[model samples]
Target: MGQGRGAVMAELMFWEAVRRAHDEELSNDPMVLVMGEDVGVVGGTYKATLGLYDKYGEDRVIDTPISENGFTGLGIGASFIGARPIIEIMSVNFAWLAMDQIFNTAAKVRYMSGGQLEAPVVIRSPGGTAHQLGSQHSARMEKVFMGIAGLRVVTPSNPRQAYGLLKSAVRCNDPVFINEHELMYNMKGEVPEEDYFHPLEGSEIVRPGRDVTLFGYNISVHWCLQAAELLSRHHGIEAEVIDLYALSPLDRSGIRDSVTRTHRAVIVEEAEPMVGVGAEVMAIINEECFYELDAAPVRVSALNVPIPYNHSLEKTALPDANDVVEAVRSMFGV
Candidate 1:
């Protein structure tokens, strides 16, 4: 069994890692059900639920109509009665329709019921601007979900994280929102075959450096990594890259610790700067490690306008690795 000790690691794509997590969790718990559009028979929109309907059967892997509010509420209500449901919103844009159930019902049920009730529902959605998917379908709404007090929000940057984080979220009693990037579905990385769980909260230092720290999450993490590489290869600057996978309850201590070490910080994000992940990370640095800064913190983010449909416009609207490199360069006067 993959659960056994010393299980070998395997390379898997982001979607396959997510599918593995769903399959394992469904097998581990009889009450774990997956519900979403095309989740059954048709699989999932991104193939995250491929073969799950056949493996687990229609009863466990359900396909709901294209009503985000209805199915999301149904999943939340199911969780209240001891059911562990993984609800997949085909696109994060449609999640706006289910805000009432997610924010009001799932997030507040435990508090409103005096701890007598809980909503252990997991809502996973693919978002981010992917090859000119247009503004409506390419919503990067992690900031919106992270603001809610009771929900756990996480965005995995790689397949290993994609595997472990989903497993951990399934076992967690709190409501979780996994914000996946649409462009990363086919990105392959090594995942441990052994059963393991990633921490629900904390930032990961993907690269260690002494000059400056670059903070990012999900797809932005890749940008930071690429920028860090370029900075080292060409500029002789060793920059640390931190992956803020958990958005809600952002790792204040980790952010402070990294900034204290590097003494300079740059946050990279695909979302617009105003009221975004970059803004929040900058706040954390300012509030917790203001004294440790060797320079003012910087943020590299997308334009304030909506994501465009024109290929060139979309490319121009979003921030990239070059943008991150330039942000750091400005700080160092490189």
Candidate 2:
């Protein structure tokens, strides 16, 4: 119905969409290239770049040394002079090493240079807890990236979003950070048979309802959807689920419209509660829809602690569908 795909086809996995998008873009442009550790021969730690090395050759599909700041800065420099480079920082935790390049150089270059130059680069990395990675490895750093002044941060919830958003990011004139989830690579969803590029701004309503509105991005979007179903079947509460694919330049109006109709809001996030996405959404609601709300907005977020290596403790640290259901129930005193 909407733009992007010309036809509908079989379900595609998250990584499959990523792979296809890389193949398509690399084949379409000579200036486009991929640079990351293990991306060339090993085909990426998550196999998202499988077969790209053989197809694009050594130059186009480069395997960089184990240096996040060095390779990321190199990619940014390349983008300034008309080259489009997709830099992969194996994990978000490692991305901290490149924070200077990402925040200072890539984000501020255009405005600081008085619009004389732009960094047309895309940084793709997986974040959030997966299995028992724990503590240092389990940071969901989207909030930090979204707070930057001139950067665009996107977190794709499904395969279609993953495919279309990645394509769109490459064409963007400014730097784009794509926060993929480690747990979502094998996730499957329906994608079009043809190429399509999703817009870098705005949000999508995945489910329609008349009661409370649930907002989430990336892995949290699925949790919101599940909560919506539980609310419908168990508590007779119909939650309208919205997927916030675009993290930065958030769709404030879209959230306002949804909350205006539903009259209640529950923001979900996989990250810590303090100064996170949920906090931002709550602030937006308080600012824009304070009069429209029937009660205070609720945030179902991860506990404020290092994600544990123990399986049970790890599960306990994060919010789940049950937590969402309870939060909604508490909103209406049910």
Candidate 3:
């Protein structure tokens, strides 16, 4: 237990892992470069690229003008010309400005060109809410990209997984959408001192149990863990928790395994219940784990209404630990 605790504590912060990934990739491949607003001087809106400018110099760690479409297109163009560009959109909400370049060019290029060209680009963005940031900034747009066939979407829930998955995304041949939860930047966890890469399509069971399966990703995963603790101590229920880090490449095996073992599932998401990732997970469970399930799968998600500015209402709107606990209890009729 002591060793395990120490190992967990040794992990790097999510932002720090991202910075290290960029540094290592930039060093290994001269074609790899970073460009975005404040990435060079301000070290990015979330400081994910801090000190990169000093090491790589201005040419590689570029600070572009406030133009998402222009820089995104420029990155895609560079990729076509043998340069691997890491484009940082300040926030996923801002990605809308570059939709044409992303969906039309980056996503379609390889398929349209019969695999002759690969858009080895990464679009990194800070997404989701940061405590009452309101509707504009808090949207989870992973589902929007789910419809696009060629894009790879990844969202790591913790520091260690964040580092591993981001490294893999950087090296992949396709365009990768790496969504960093705004509230998870400062979170710390044990990442191996040596470099590592998590498979793009794999999901990990963060906690093991037999009573129920609690599925989530990003910040919601943390809440699931909290609810798991409460369920174990207060309700005497052991809830298995699975983090579906990569949203687009759904880890059906992990979801199926957990549901088969527990025979009950409760998916928690910070996004809306309607058309959110939770809905997709629930559907997948219904198809894959329907016979194994002892009770109907459930989803605990944010309210469909626009996020309120009021703190109390905002707290009520998003899925909380209690929501997860109640879902688990309700699923088992306990």
Candidate 4:
């Protein structure tokens, strides 16, 4: 939504958009609190919460100890008592320590309690193989979170989505997990000046075409867009680009609609292919649009090996725009 009449749009880096969202939501809702390591005093590991500590003070923008399980559980518990807490795990790899709180408590509270309880908790974390962060640190664990029942999973690809999605998640009654990319914090894009909420469901058609569908989210979205451009210019093959921002409760109808129109599909991701987003999307294609397809759905994903710290190996382990282009060429037999 372009700013209503007099409202002007401003360009902001992804992290800035996130900080703005946090700042606005905290101001609008007194119950809303942000808790995490360095989130208060240090303004977040990626500076996504920069300057909020002083503005909101220590109580609202409280900083916790390094214990992921302790702080995450504490936030989840507070949510049940009417606190709309935004809990940021410093890194997704560290989230393993908080699985009990996330999967068992926050996710299951509403269902297990028969709607009497609500887990209005938002867990946000940044993950990905960003510039040789190593195997442990370079974890793309969105698939793991998406698979959990009673949990809402979403990943934002740009500054606009980053701002809107976070705002929406804070207000949602169901527990929301926002998987952000490690490398996209400094990425710049236009964001609306006024407050807005991006739906926690549905896929977005970023680019329209008829030949094939390219599905991506987060960092891989840029790859799909780049590949779509090359396919159109060099090969005369128009590829549609779809952003699957919502991972859990995926837009099944959207996938069917796109594949039915294009008759071919290519799912791109920055994670390994096994049991990942690409695999799940391919399954959806087979189940819902198998008869409409002209070719087998393909996936462009990271290699099955652990992400190496060495720069060359790290680059080789991940799929890129060229990989997406090559996959599209193979589909078209170009």
Candidate 5:
């Protein structure tokens, strides 16, 4: 909110915020180090861990081989022994190879050990359909990771959260999964230069409105904001937008309060409709504010089909601002 690096609020690309987070954490904590494929010499697939290789050297900024499962297991093992490991899978598509370690080990170790073990590790991967990345490469694994029992899940919509949330995740003792959007690497947003850390749990009301609430996180959060502006300017419908950043330890109170006040909601997600954050938010609305609701909650989500490689087909597969606006308009019959 204030000045960054002696400048009047630093404007940074999403990857820069990510890189800053990794840089800060690695510098601040002796035990904090990075491990993943090409995270060393090549500077990560998305460059989210750039320069750390040079700054921290080989031991701290580790470069793992091609085995996702092996390195993921190694990272979790490192965390178990008190070293905070930040494992970056080049893509969520590749993370499937490490599911056994993520779900059975990292997510369950603390519980399985009866609190004797703390898997204080953070696994980050960029997911969702990005341009022509095919179905196999474009899986939004948030639904899968968020559903796990003992994991904390979060997705940041902008640079500030990317910086702040990663800092928080590093300090937290629980196993955390950060799902960054594949297409949001270059999206620019402001980040204060001051040392700031956003909470691991909670949602922020990005825009205040009276008509209906629009909910999203990561890239979908931008879609909600864009739709909210259109609804306000063209249709006179003021739509409140909520950034549901913490997907696992969901901010139920925030969701309840906004849905209670607005009485209608439209959830925008890049993931499929079935068993998603949309469905969970809708369930919460039905349970907490059923009588307050004037209309059924609507979910504007990607099609159930696998993400097509064709650009046009991919566009059709994902939800957009127009879909959100139309969904909100339908609630009020406007």
Candidate 6:
């Protein structure tokens, strides 16, 4: 069931990918377990861990109290004792309660111990805006961890990348933060069952073109892909779309290669522009691909404001497919 090329094209939802990754890892490793609020009986808020408690039993699949800080600290302690705990934060909004454990402990334990101990912990959390989930729950906290040192930040855009990256994050010997977009849980795409692992450092080109390079990650990557298709069909401009799976370890090589080929670039991100991930990508392009650029690196991102409750206002605040198309057009003076 885990092999054969035919299994690669089987479409799976994002939550299904998470389920597959956890199930496979748990079955193989005795130390691997999952703990979070309502994860056991309730099958997780997003249903990512559904049916796990039945198969793995209560000891392996645990339901913690509504205490992010306490349970996260417990996970860190367990990791110190050689148990690889998959700590699921109910949402990135709740993760604030566990910042001390995440930043001060999970991120620094191995380095502080001088290679004597390893914290193979994976903290999975749902992040970003979805279905008008208020100001606190709708926030995109990728920048918070991006600033922290000694931690791996990954945000996969599609089911394939999500599955592969989650698998790799589970097997790694360091603290890994896997940010799954709340809106992307039901999004479906093909994932290989042949145990494929994409490196967590580099970027993947989703679409190849010559006119402009569109940089994206997480939900923005799928938006850029749609924008690329629109730009080709409606405006006759070919746009190269790059999905940056790993945000912290930015893929300079992939960005450089794409920018060198396309000469024009536009970075698209769901976060606000002022101090967001797009700003970092723009800086990298300016530093590394400055000579190759034919135009300034344009950034199409959410406006620098809190996401509104009104559907229309929220949609306007976030970068849409049209925003990407316009940004690409503006970059090329078209």
lDDT tens per residue, model 4, 128-205: 888878889999999999989999999999998999999999998999999999899999998889987888999999
Better of 3 and 6 by TM-score: 6
What's the CA RMSD for each of the models?
Answer: 1.8, 1.1, 2.9, 1.5, 2.0, 2.0
- Clash counts for the predictions, in order: 0, 0, 3, 0, 1, 0
Q: Considering every candidate listed, which one attains the maximal TM-score?
A: 2
On the 0 to 100 scale, the lDDT of residue 165 in model 6 is 80
Candidate 2 Cα misplacement greater than 4 A, ranges: none
Ten-residue region with minimum lDDT total, candidate 5: 1-10
| lDDT of candidates 1 onward, in order | 0.92, 0.93, 0.86, 0.93, 0.91, 0.86
Q: Ten residues in a row with the worst lDDT in model 1?
A: 1-10
Question: For candidate 4, what is the lDDT?
Answer: 0.93
Candidate 4 colliding pairs: none
Clashes of 3: 3
Model 2 clashing residue pairs (backbone): none
Give stretches of model 3 more than 4 Å off: 1-10
Query: Per-residue lDDT of 177-239 in model 1, one digit per residue for the tens?
Result: 999999899999988888868888998999999999999999999999999999999899999
lDDT of 3 by residue, 235-321 (tens): 899999998888887888888988999998999888888887888998899888899988888999989888888889888888899
Mind sharing the TM-score for model 1? 0.97
TM-score (C-alpha, index-matched) for candidate 5: 0.97
Model 2, 25-128: lDDT tens digits are: 99989999999999999999988899999998999999999999999999999998989999988999999999999998999999999999899999999998
lDDT score, residue 236, model 3?
A: 96
